[model samples]
Target: MDGWKVGVLHSQTGCLALAERGPLNGTLMAIEEINAAGGVAGRLIEPVVLDTESDENKSAELVHKLIKEESINVVFGGYTSASRKAMLPVIEKSDSLLFYPIFYEGFELSDNVFYTGACPNQYSVPLSEYLFENYGNRFYLIGSNYVFPRESNRILRDLAVQNGGTIIAEKYVPLEATKDVFKPIIQDIAKLKPDVVISTIVGDGIMDLYSAFQDAGISSDEIPIASMVTSEVEIEKMGHAAAAGHIVAASYFDTIDSPENAKFVSNYKSKFGQNMRTNMCVESAYCQVHLFAHALNITQSIDTKALRAAVLGAQFNAPQGRIRMDVENHHTHLWSRIGQIEKNGNIQIVAETKGAIEPDPYMIHHAAERWQPSLISGVAK
Candidate 1:
């Protein structure tokens, strides 16, 4: 039995670098941990890393190279829906598995992939209830022009209107948009004065949008930019002082007070850097590797067929809490938490689900009542 080879596809240098780098770090760390502990049945897991450079087309080309040329059957990476979609046909045709670790708008599912991130029901639904309840119903929507932000906004609009909330405006910008692009949005935000600025902007644009708001002297206390994509990674990069008071909804945060998370954080910092932080992407990336290792051990084979079966109904005590891969859906059941960035760049959990919420990828089972009782208050904000 030879050592197993897996592909690590994450954008190293690009607009998405700030966002994708943490997951790459986490994936490598987890592989190291498994290999150190006597990797899958004594065969080390070899990761063939690639730099997608945050380009969707490039992501597709590199993934083809990984599978056909490199012969990697298992791959772990992907930050954006666009990249994932671009790689989908190749993955499905080759019958390989891609472990995706970023939360995204849930509308599609694939057989050749294990989704380890939160779906909208697990993130957006609970988050919406909180925002409308606490921050008020009128929301100003701004997002990076892409499928995810657009889909997420659709979900938010449905939820908002159902709850008698209103969307004051909806806007989209290019991924390469500058801070100046947000100036007009700020003007409208001030004029309309929505109760909350709901932002789904991704990549470098996140920092730019926040910075523009800060420059405009817009107080978050007056209208915080409650975000779906911003995490400690962005908060850390954007500076704690600048990122403070903004909200983020995800399955995990760096500051979750739990034994599992504490250990994960400690080991991660020790390996990466004393100051390196973990967010939803990093935590999920780390957990999926462990989950894959467990599956590999149980089946004693890396065959996509055996693994596809073994990975289902798998459970791991993740940094966020108990998480499970749904046997039927292939989407992870994950904890939901809404956090506000602190002055020190930590996302302080303000509200959380009682337990890991079920994934509703297609939103077929979605209902307003499902989110109401799931979340409970945490540290006072």
Candidate 2:
């Protein structure tokens, strides 16, 4: 077998760089580890890196170049749904595979893309149920003005109303907007006094939004912010004081307690440094590389048909828990977890599903009640 040329297409310098960098680092780390272990199938994996720079157009352009010019068959990166959509056409035309490692709004299926992250039903639905049950029945939605945030909020609204909750208000801000765009939202929160703020805000905009909330003297204790994208890294960027008491739903956290997770965390910190933060995206990227290697081993090639057939229903003991790629939808079956941001900017797990939930990207199943439990103290703030 010839050395496989892989494409690394995560943005390294755009508005979403703060979040995308984690996945890029995770992907690189896996490559290094795999190469050190005598390579995959005795063929070294070579990476051709491209900076999408958080631009959807640029993401699409670069993906086409990777497939055509660089001859890379497998691409691993795309932190946001907008970027993924932008690249979809090029991927489909070329029949190349993309290993997307971030949780998204779902409702998408592509033969050219292998989704390694949770779908809407995996995080958003469960998170909505958690907030509605514990925080109250009123919610205000805010997010970056993009495909992911918009579609995610739409899904959340449906889940909330189905569970007998109300949407007090909804708003969006440009991905690269400044504090000015968030001020009025904070003001609205002050006036409406909604039970909770469901934020789909991503990237650096999160720091601005959280800071504005604190500046307005609106504490999470007043109306806790519930989120699917806000991670420990964002909390650290927003500062402990501003981000504390907020709730986040994810498939994994740096604070998870497990022998496998501990070793994963230890190894990541040892290589990246103890201060670096590891979140869901990072872990999924790491796992995707291993999953790809296993598939390549099974098929002895990176052909789309062979790889997909080999990887369908593939199981991996991820840092979060045991996860599997659903053969039907090509989405992942993941464990759902709810965590409250602590005063120190770390997440404390408060509620979690008992096992890995099946991927329901199309939302055909109604299992929101599965993750909802009796309100626990210190969770709803």
Candidate 3:
């Protein structure tokens, strides 16, 4: 809506800077397109952008200000789980809506939130199945010291063990850890010799980890690396030579071949700049804005509760593919794609799920599911 204000919360100057900028830009792009095409419901979407600075505490404060002071209707931002978690209390207390657009570990559900992103089913499960089928049954986990990476690794480890894969080494490094710090970790990994390395390290940590792995002579051809967070945005930051041959799983990529995506890419390049790259987070933000617009149009109102109700079980043909919100989990059911980072900084979708996998936030199907349905159910209540 032309006069409607939305909060754009992201880290424009911290560890998540590279990852968050794309989505923020993408959200802006969607808003611009909607405005140019006669706006949403004859209202132009105006975003009051706030910088979280990759600080969880700062994010919480910003969310409070955005909701209370700015009186923004919805917040759509944050790249890491930590930032989202930090903003949760504020959102819950204020009863404000947050459309979080990022794939994350499945163990959370909130009525005050619309997670238009992949959960475990959209990434972990499919990736685990792929590794089990193609690669041998040995794995190692590496990640930044954060809730998303830790929880993701736990789920991955459980999946690997359940699927007859063995976890040889699991390590975590602080988000700001130096490159030399990972050398010994790489040495340990080399000794343990896992068949595949599943890494969740983000930002600078990823550069260090990958560089260490390469310097230690641990090539992807020898011990392939698969990551949940590394995407076109991060790969571009790390440079092609450093990221080549690594596998990554996500719901969207810049290279997706579809008429809708082609148009999206063309429009994105034109709006953001030809040198800019698109990634899953950006696509998810774009999808979220469109979905929100659809809900508003269908209901013809911006009542938070009504919008939530309208969105709960809604499905939309997003640019990436068809996506539906899982009422039980509050996460979007989406198709997962496994892509390889080529030497040219482009992703090649090597494999994808046959259909959209339902988001299982409570992990009902897995035997060692860490979260209880009651926890998520209570949170939503």
| Top of the candidates by TM-score | 1
Model 2 residue 30 lDDT? 87
In candidate 1, list every pair of residues with a backbone clash. Answer: none
Model 2, C-alpha of 188: deviation from truth (Å): 1.6
User: What lDDT is reached at residue 370 by model 3?
Assistant: 32
Question: Against the hidden true structure, what lDDT does model 3 obtain?
Answer: 0.81
Q: Candidate 2's residue-wise lDDT over 328-365, tens digit each?
A: 88888888889989899889998887778888888887
The regions of model 1 sitting more than 4 angstroms off are: 379-381
Q: CA shift at 175, candidate 1, in angstroms?
A: 1.2
- What is the overall TM-score of model 3 with all chains considered together? 0.92
- As a whole number from 0 to 100, the lDDT of residue 56 in candidate 1 is 87
Q: Using lDDT as the measure, which candidate wins?
A: 1
Q: Model 1, poorest ten-residue lDDT window?
A: 372-381
Instruction: Point out the higher-scoring one by lDDT: 1 or 2.
Output: 1
Tell me how far the alpha carbon of residue 212 in candidate 2 is from the true structure, in angstroms, after superposition. 1.1
Best-to-worst order by TM-score is: 1, 2, 3
Clashing pairs in 3: 1-43, 1-44, 2-43, 2-44
Q: Which stretches of candidate 2 lie over 4 Å from their true place?
A: 367-381
lDDT of 1 at 28: 98
> Which model, 2 or 3, shows the larger TM-score?
2
